[model samples]
Target: MATGTGIGTEIQISDSSDEQVILKTKMIKLDTHNWVQWSCQMENYLTARRYDDLFMPPSEETKRSSKFRQKNSSALALLWGCVSSELEGVLLDNKTSFYDTWEVLGNICGKNSIVTICETFYELISLKYKPESSLQAHIHSFQKLCARYNSITSDKVLKATFPPKLLAATFIRSLNGDKELTGLVQTLYDIKPFTPAAVISRVAIEHSRRQPNEQALFAGSSNKSMQKTKWDEQKQRNKGQRSGKKYDKPGPSDKNDSDKRMDNIKKMLEKLQASMKPQSAHLTTESNIKTVVPTLMLS
Candidate 1:
């Protein structure tokens, strides 16, 4: 089997006999969310089936060959089968040849243009782990962005500018807000050969380890909220009771004190009147004695 396509491009032709690569498992269906994975898987499928040459532009020498036509047809059918129903429109007018369909798919879903590469690079670096979402989901999203960045960048002249180790570091950096996961990932990075798979494995173990603690914290917060509500209700009830009966108004003890003060003033006034009457009676008796003595002497 010719290893090279004689076009300065290196091709890997399988040593296995040219047997029909029957579909053993379902191929990954293409969707907006999974374009990176889909393209990667599709390329693997193409290479394995020895039909990857259909992806390249047909040279003048082989463009008219019947062998190219047969292989191109098979590759085109494979692409059409992999596309999801919603994205079927992308293939409608673009399916002129295998190369055309592949390029169109790359331009649309793969974002093969320079502008899209920049956008994808920015997205990959800025991808952060959301605390509200599951750890596994965040990791999955991180992996997708890394894969997407590589896929888009691979189309450029400077292919795969960022290495896998660099991508792993970027992923670890994305976990800056999470101390435990960051530490765990960093330790794994320092301790062993740091790959994306290793980071994911260690992070997953740490996440599972922390699950019970997270649940306990959530339950504790719920209990605190319930207690606060109960306290607020009790306070409102006490306030309502105090409002119903005015606590500041005079009570029975106050009224009794006022009555006792009035009785003491009345008793003091009676005593003063009795003493003045005695003084007046004594003065009158003294005058009568003087007059009686003078009359007896005259008799």
Candidate 2:
């Protein structure tokens, strides 16, 4: 029967053997604390089904847009070098947040679209995204920084954080040398106020540089991706399947669940004391250190 959109519990599993042996089985439900788990599971499902719904072909526009979408500093530096310095201007001005002390500036204004937002002191992320808007709507803030830096600096974008795969992609692109992007090499370092579109162009150029010998970049990208994924997988394993708790370590909930908690040594002492023959066990000085004095001297 169709249990509908939400998860339905009481899933059943059955096991049977020959000779009339029967046993009850248990059910399993899947959910995680965050969307990452949901996304990974969804990807696994799609891969298993061989679904081709969302495969996007590489496009100049998409490539150009990727700088802003680039992974954070760790991956960006390995992929691009110091040529990505223009990223400094892309700094997030977060003076606002409910949970945080600073407030967030909410505008999608670009150096290109200076007409819309009149604010002179800070940059804005618009707190929202729109396709027709000057800035990219859904792109992550850091990814755009790479694009903005690359665009203004051209092909010469240096990055503080780099991913080896991005370098591999760039190295492969270098083989073709479309010289049309000749100026791009210089612009990545251009430390001037620029727009989101400039960022997109830089990213496109970077990807184009790899398009010539796509195979190597592809392989490098794939291997590096796998390595990265492996690292992430290792991280998830650490997260979901951490090493069993140490003998002395207590879980976060242990403080609240004191009633269910056990003092192994105390329990053992009680068992030993109860099992011992009358007065068979005598407390020594070392054991007496923890002994309780029941009587008090007269004041």
Candidate 3:
């Protein structure tokens, strides 16, 4: 018997004449154990090889494999199903491991996958798992649609993308207080910067001119009430940062208004004294006449 065969992993033969003969066979099956073992096996198979035994830190190669990076909508559908909609506590049951799986999922598919995944997962529960027989006719259709989309494989583009009606329908089905739904919405919001959001920014800016408002959004436009807010916050941070440095003693720029007024008075007095001198008499006379005539003529 082989070393791994003791727990039912391999096959063994009693006598072999050139050709191999199977005396006994062993296989892992769902009948004996629930999905826990199967899920673990699937997860391991996906993440086995890595740079380091302790931790395989992120890098370029790791990112390329993410389902999130590929924009595979199916990944989103499956994620929403398992985690957001809590498809039978499937994701939560092995959360630690699931998180590990999610890291890879996000790296490959792009985070948008989460929203679709959650929506699809909820549909699966409502249509197939829980609906009473009366409204259950579409159950098979639902599963059939989801069969190839469980979690989005990286190497293929088989089943069609869900149409907007179907996609939106699935998401709205379980509007259950699934916290992950918030994350999914956030992902959708972030990925749509190039679409209607661009137009929305222009419209919002026009509205801003008519009303007082604030938010640091609009990428380059003044609509960045949020950016302005952040800039203000950053300015405060910079002030604190400068305060921390061992700066030189305050310079002339730090002088008070009184000091500036005194300096201006001194300059004026010096100018008046210079003008009163013998050499400045002509200039003073001309200046005095120019100053007096304007007031006299106006009066």
Best model per lDDT: 1
- Candidate 3, 141-182: lDDT as tens digits: 554545534443222442334444454345334332434334
Residue 275, model 2: Cα distance from true site in angstroms? 3.1
The local lDDT score (0 to 100) that residue 127 gets in candidate 1 is 87
TM-score of each: 0.46, 0.16, 0.18
Lowest summed-lDDT stretch of 10 residues in model 2? 97-106
Against the true structure, candidate 1 reaches a TM-score of: 0.46
Query: How does residue 189 of candidate 1 score in lDDT?
Result: 66
Candidate that beats the other on lDDT, 1 or 3, i.e. the better one: 1
After superposition, the stretches of candidate 1 with alpha carbons farther than 4 Å from their true spots are 1-21, 31-35, 84-96, 130-141, 158-173, 176-299
For each candidate, the alpha-carbon lDDT, in order, equals: 0.66, 0.34, 0.40
Poorest stretch of ten by lDDT in candidate 3: 46-55
lDDT per residue as tens, model 1, 213-252: 8899999999999999988966665576457633333344
Query: Quick one: best TM-score, which candidate?
Result: 1
Q: Which ten residues in a row have the lowest lDDT in candidate 1?
A: 1-10
Which model is ahead, 1 or 2, in terms of lDDT? Answer: 1
